[model samples]
Target: MDKALPRTIACVTAVLGLALALAGPAAATPGVPAPEASADGTLVSRTGTAVTVTAAVGLSNTISVWQAGDTIRVRDTGDTVTALGGCRPVSANEAVCPGAGSLTELVVHAGDQADDVTSFLESLGVTLVGGAGDDSLYGGGANDTLEGDEGADFLSGGGGNDTLTGSSGRDRLFGGPGNDSIEGRGGGDLINAGAGNDVVSGGNGNDQVIAGTGNDFVDGGPGQDTLDAVDEVGGNDYVRGGDESDTCRADLGDSVTECP
Candidate 1:
């Protein structure tokens, strides 16, 4: 951690607020105030220094923390963050942090984790994605999407437009932001929506999904699945698919999708 950077990490509680505060680093161009992070969200800073982040518990996924000057990508293992770009040797094990190009496109991709990576982000007040050993994901205040390739993963879209995919795992997903999308490709999965128009899909397994508080779309691709709209307002929802024995419940002004 650098001594000049602020000690307090801002944890953003809302995606829209984060977007309004800093309109993506991509637009900032060169020679501007880099995106400064706080426990509440991103801030404006013109300093170059390193900050040590203490990891939080019960939060899975890898976080890519960015600054205008430079970055130090710390991996749980040497191969934890695959495809590392612009990382130079800093010490025997640590390397110089890589720049995230632009703020609009802050890319921090996590490959696999033996534990929950969310705690690290929460402690540091950042948002990120990657593999989890538990396969269960809890979303935060940033617009994030996650995928679990194995095990039964549970995911929540805390805020912002999010996309979640549980590939090859029985998963649970929740959409809690801007029009969100979810896909569960294996095992039985569950999905829920909150405060935004959403699209959810289940594949090759028995699944349960609900569209709550927004005009939403639910797609139960295969196997015995359940779709319900007990907690939703105007926007209209679509429920599609029927494999083996599937059930669907809806209200008026909602679209029911049953495509064979």
Candidate 2:
């Protein structure tokens, strides 16, 4: 990454006297590939955030705990991982981790357990990949991207306009208070575009879409999907059930077509 990460992380170590001792990029694994591109930001954390920060993708069934300066690889057995980025534990799910690299976007692999991975409030355009267990992935107050890879997952975008994608398992994609875009890539999914205008797509399964109170667009791609905007206080939403046997319901200010 040519861009230098934000300098905030250096401040944390200088203030706390923590043993950051940042490491160079770990040698790449045999078959796994490095990330295609990297975004720039410091990696901070909040409490109750599952899945430790990572430098590598495609990890499985393990929490990759790296140090302040360590490359984002899974912590080897002999590698010493400190206390929540060397700050003392605040709670059971300790966070407030302070670290950063050249890239800010993330492609997580949180393994087979349920996880709640939330980006820092200062982050933007982060991309996370959840695991096979029910997970909740949240984008912060800026434009971000998240992918629910498997299991019954929940992807929510915060105040900034964001993008949410789902996978083969049932999912809930919520575009929070910003004008956002979301797609249920697979499975029987629930797409809720919560406040602000949005674009929603049910990729390839029986889906239920809730376009909440915004001038929005909904597309049920290829299954018996339910496009619902029946609330009285809803906005003018355009609903479409693609070339499939689907159900499209809406209010007066909305327009629906192509259900047949």
Candidate 3:
């Protein structure tokens, strides 16, 4: 009876070991993992034409702010964030940052009192319908379009594919890069199309046009004017000194003569 009892106990122990092995490893605790630390933080505010952006402690280095149309964009390298100042979320890493009433398009009508307007944020689009007084318009950095109608205006396209039109004033137009179009209509104007493929025209006034780099088309219409299509590498450009006696200069023997 003692030997039989020992054999029975051994068999039971072996069976228990087999069942334990069949039950697989214990399941891990069922819960979500903790999130990582955020990399950027930002705050935005505005007063009149001036807009301010402040970054959180330790996150100032990683945050960048820019303007697109009427909306400002705040970017963070870390986690996604909600909108601020009525700005819409652009992506997980970016949000539109605006101060109070943000504008997607800023238009200045004729007879308005404002003379100088500037866009602090990069990429904001602005349009000026000139009054009798002279005006100055600046497009910081982004694809911007500016029009000067009437007064002798100064328009600058900081960066991007900017389109600037000066109508009826002795204006100065500058196109920064990324393919630009500049036109001076009815007054003596100065135009510089800097880099990228550009189209520049001086209508009716004694104008000076410089096509800087890339393929360009330049026209000096009416009065005596100067057209320069010369670059370091002598770009491929089509230049026409229209109407009255004009001077046309080109590099690498690139052909530029009288208007067709």
Name the candidate, 1 or 2, with the larger TM-score value: 2
What is the C-alpha local distance difference test score of each model?
A: 0.50, 0.58, 0.60
**Index of the highest-lDDT prediction:** 3
> lDDT (0-100) at residue 54 of candidate 1?
25
How are the candidates ranked when ordered by TM-score, highest leading?
2, 3, 1
Which TM-score value belongs to model 1? 0.57
Runs of candidate 3 exceeding 4 Å displacement: 1-114
Per-model TM values vs. the true structure: 0.57, 0.61, 0.59
Q: Give candidate 2's error at residue 117 in angstroms.
A: 1.0
lDDT score for residue 23 of model 3: 20
* 10 residues in a row with least lDDT, candidate 2: 21-30
Score residue 63 of candidate 2 by CA lDDT: 34
Relative to the true structure, candidate 1 has a C-alpha RMSD (angstroms) of 15.4
Compare the candidates by TM-score and give the number of the best one: 2
Q: Tens digit of lDDT per residue, candidate 1, span 1-260?
A: 35322321221123223333332331222221223222311111211332232222333433334233444344332222222234444433233444433223332323334334342222122333444355445555556645555566667756667666775666777777666666777788887766676666677788888777665556687788887865633224555666666788775434455632
Task: Arrange candidates, best lDDT first.
Answer: 3, 2, 1
